[model samples]
Target: MKTQDQAAQGKVALVGAGPGDPELLTLKAVKAIFRADVLLVDDLVNPDILDHARFGARIIHVGKRGGCQSTPQEFIERLMIAEARAGHFVVRLKGGDPFIFGRGGEERAHLLDAGIEVDIINGISSGLAAPSSIGIPLTHRDWSQGAVFVTGHGKTADANPDWDALAKLGMTLVIYMGVARCREIQQALLAGGKPASTPVAVVHAATSGSQAQLITTLGDLPAALTESRLASPSIIVIGDVVRCASQDLFHRLTAEPDRIAG
Candidate 1:
């Protein structure tokens, strides 16, 4: 296989920068960053992660906020093709795992169609990081033996989703990038037969030095967030395993009552 340094004309590395903290990056990801001639980073890709890049790396920031001046998806595809076509080692760096929510799939498909060699590197997802940051274990032998991940902003925004056997899955529920519509999700879950009192944890800026967790019941999701003042981009976890959080691995990463989110 040609290494990133080989500088092949039609090769791209889809690298996940992890949650936020620079320290969380894997060694392989760092190596990719160092070898890349151009970096296409997401809006949420932490600046600290970019410090690992080689000097003079061409950095291209692609906007991806809820209500920001964002680059069109097609335009980004073209950018990747153009950069990779130029024989530059291109690293497409996304905040979370590239395959999770990032449009890495679309980009990969496009690149593959063009016959560009693409390498995908997995990174810790905020979906996992957020729960761990707040001491919430997504699964427990007693509480839950499985887990499910869902996006809060996708379809079924207003309508009740007929969750297919999810209620009996005995799995912890996790919602990523879903703070604004969390209440609806909670309601849907409850309507689907999930207990109203299921424990819920809202973790903000998870896995970073600055992290905040809000403990609440599934029934009180909207109220809890409104009172706690946590906003979008935060991870939402729901299940009974959260009851053990304070003494778990995320104990040290938990933030104080007032957290600086930005």
Candidate 2:
């Protein structure tokens, strides 16, 4: 039981809203929402999650979607600091695992430097959820020995990943925000000796009603994405593990009852 004075003390909670499904939100995240005096939400978070916020909680949209008008990170930090300093419980709600490519580290550093107490609540990252939703396992004893998660978009072109090193690993590669530079990524992987026949799948709007997927070969990834016209907020999965979805075992399990009867 927290006293009113303790409740009013300035603090910040960096909460992960999970991938997209509102039901996937963690119980701890829901509790933080209810306790929040102000919520700084990301652009990718589903609106339904906000329903958990207590009545009269101030909600501020500070989403930063790629290639669109975005709230500056610096500004968002300053605002959070200001709000918390004013004795408000601030919740910085982000989509996916806040620590994974959500810039949660940066925000946490800023708040800590400003003498604000920070709490972190982890959530499911799309990297894991997207592939699982599509029946693609990141690791399988028969196929992939391990898995690697990397961001397709970096702070700068020079910061781009070393695709050659990744190709040598011979493991599942899950790329986040890679749609915009699919061609470049494809070329890099090809140059790094990855086979053209490597299986690739792009999951769009994962875990949402609008969720969709496109499966193709590594060599054809660019063309397939172009033909499908899939947009951002997509995860690109590559490796032999992708073939697991098409295996006879999976097909048999998912086969319709009518088909099985026939």
Candidate 3:
């Protein structure tokens, strides 16, 4: 437990910057950023969002991007601890929702262990914003009963998500950081009994000005991705819900003729 004096002295806020769009930030998150004495930002966070920071607020970029050199996790934790100990309100601004694959849980645990006060502000996850940006609902009553948000990359090869089990769930699967391993993931899902014809949509930089997307089938995902050249920081949405994407986006891919009401 944090002592009253410790809590009053300093604190840290795990603020989600939302997807890529600066306007997507929640009101409370805006307030947190404006009041922050120091901000530790993630690589994926939109730079425009920083406009909300109060003038003269110290901003530190601690980017963590896959397949690229990133700030060490241990170092980031120590910095937050140090800043908070100095009686500064530290904001760990991250892209998307902090709790959803953002490593917020790990950070929270470390802060508590160090007796530092921590609070989390929710942001819209890219998984949700990405699909919605192009009019693809993750779940639909006539098609999907639920949605599953999963990471495409595992901490270790052996620790990867059970793609087979996930396929068997029959729920909408929204994969993050899976763009790099598209081929492997496609094979796993196919082997897990998912049909080759399953609709899939890969949205890159969802809700951002440079947003782009490709709609394809599970079997064609790898090839389509190669041909489309869409890269990481993308969301792969798999299921019939992908078929519900806006008509404009549907033109680029060969989709089944209107199966369900849009």
Candidate 4:
């Protein structure tokens, strides 16, 4: 009934779902979800956020978790292109800010190469949410003048962050995907002249109802995590600004050395 030129010309939207809180989604993200004909969702996106989707919308779960089996990136890109060419509004929903380690850049490049239209809607990043949830200010006049967000793990060994240079930056350090490599990260920072007494905070599932957190010094981080049993999907904040965390959340694990708050 319709010719190729008469069919709808669909576009792709790379929308950030925020850090696990449905309420944290931006107004633009909500509208995009409502308008999408097909949504490719990542594992970290909150399932509840789908309530905004229009009825009869196709939702595809493309789980991508570190150290777990995940949908291939190539397949996702191809699907987006195929769906768009078929006159479907494709929404690629990712957790946290899409540009902040969510692989939005890669997807955008692929879509452009295929001559598909794309739009990006930003959302709150977990790095910002994790520290704020506990009342820890990332930047303080007396504590830290700025902050740096780095990934603890990289796609490849050579892709890993330079912990040595990061240690000497004299700013608040917020680490993503660092829990599995806690000991290695700690040792690298220590070897790079970061003091063993530097304060650290590890927040799990930050901003979610099941959130948990621990506070300790750099030297005790590995042991603290082992005791707390906090795993991936956690944010590690390192610097003096951790001292600014709310007293209500502070529980001293021991009094001998630096205080371990759990």
Candidate 5:
């Protein structure tokens, strides 16, 4: 029989908040949020989803926004360990699928090393959702044999993906957080033998009311992005499948001039 203190040792739940839509949150994620005594939320997570938390649940904003004053990963891990040891059911809420560039793995490792149990609740990733929202299929038998998802930014400069190799993969490429480096990416792909006429699309704030999209060709991508002023929190899709976007659906997706472009 364990003592009260021993039995009170709490566990951590790494919950994915999905892209920007509250409705995209998984039932497991919702249940985790409702049961959490404390939640460490990320910057990109939609605020509306927080409403799922039970009244009196302590919400902590530990979001790490790029190019901004962000929470240190070490600090976040420590906070989670501290909260859990204090007998609080801690929920580390992140935008998109927690394992998909959300750094959930690092947090899980830290907690496990500290002897804290961690549960992962998967959610929709923007890499998949964004393209679909704009009528672009990631993979199509006639257009692409496969697809690849790569991050635009890496922890170190040398860790950056080899654009040349990626271009040679002969598959659709879905880039996350690549808006800032769109010009460099375009140049790399162009130099890697990818045709200048390859179709491309940029989807911003996917699955949310503020969602927007831009359709262009590889040759025009850099200039199009510069002229359009699309920013971070966007996904870039490149491949022949972009050409497969239904004409009627494209028109409907772009109906709001302010929210879409070509």
Candidate 6:
């Protein structure tokens, strides 16, 4: 019995586009995009996702691209604030899970401060999705129990990741924005007494057609990754779980004679 007028009041939804794969999007997120009156998105988000917006909504691009002059975060928040104030439902879309370096926290705080009704729609993060697609488990009783997600691409002033702790902890290490620092990080971990032969898996353009998963050892990770010509938006995973993905894929690929070379 709700009136159409009552339903038209503005609301804001922060949506996660997932790590470049449209298939990885959650159903709720898909529904929210389709319902949006205005969609504000980031550059990392894949283009295919826009097909889900069935409402013929206005799509606004306010994304922060790597190495580019990013549109100020405060400006993006104000855009959301201004649009929602006009009584249009706005969707702030980001690539990957919103909470994981997606900058959703800032926007959330801004909207709430302005007294706008807001909600977050979670999506798959590349951290876990990339490895899983390559058939790696993050934890194993026999290998390692903890999994650490770190950002390796940001400013040195903010944090050059704690190489010392990561080296000693037996956790599965998942690093984002790692391409730039791959060599340095690998060397640091190697210097910290982490086995030079420890397995490492680098997933590039994960969960998409351009995807490539390369398995190598920590010592050779830098060379292997560089040789493969993989680009940004990739993830680097180190630990025994690297073997898990390789073994799983090997068994599966080996089991299928059709896939094997004659």
Candidates sorted by lDDT, best first: 4, 3, 2, 5, 6, 1
lDDT of 3 by residue, 1-262 (tens): 9677666678899999999999899999999999999999999999999999999999999988878999999999999999898899999999999999999999999999988889999999999999999899998999999999999998999989999999899999999999999999999999999999898898998888889888888888888888778888899999999878888667545544322111
The CA lDDT of each predicted structure is: 0.78, 0.88, 0.90, 0.91, 0.88, 0.82
* Deviation in Å, model 2, residue 95 alpha carbon: 0.7
The candidate, 3 or 6, that scores higher on lDDT is 3
Q: What is the C-alpha RMSD of each candidate to the true structure, in Å?
A: 4.9, 5.2, 3.3, 2.5, 3.1, 5.1
Model 3 residue 158 CA deviation in Å: 1.8
TM-score of 6: 0.87
lDDT of 5 by residue, 88-163 (tens): 9999999999899999888899999998989999989999999888678899999899999999888899988899
lDDT of 3 at 18: 94
Q: Where does candidate 1 have its weakest 10-residue lDDT segment? A: 253-262
Clashes of each: 1, 1, 0, 0, 0, 0
Query: Where does candidate 5 have its weakest 10-residue lDDT segment?
Result: 251-260
Q: Per-residue alpha-carbon lDDT of model 4 for 46-97, expressed as tens digits?
A: 8999999999999999998888999999999999999998889999999999
Score residue 76 of candidate 4 by CA lDDT. 97
TM-score, one value per model: 0.87, 0.91, 0.94, 0.94, 0.93, 0.87
Flag regions of model 3 displaced more than 4 Å: 1-8, 255-262
**Candidate 6: tens digits of C-alpha lDDT, residues 30-84:** 9999999999988888999999997579999986765667788888888888888
Q: What lDDT does model 2 reach?
A: 0.88
Please give the lDDT score for candidate 4.
0.91
Once fitted onto the true fold, the runs of candidate 4 whose alpha carbons sit more than 4 angstroms away are 1-7, 251-261
Error of 4 at 242 (Å): 0.5
User: Which of 5 and 6 is the better model by lDDT?
Assistant: 5
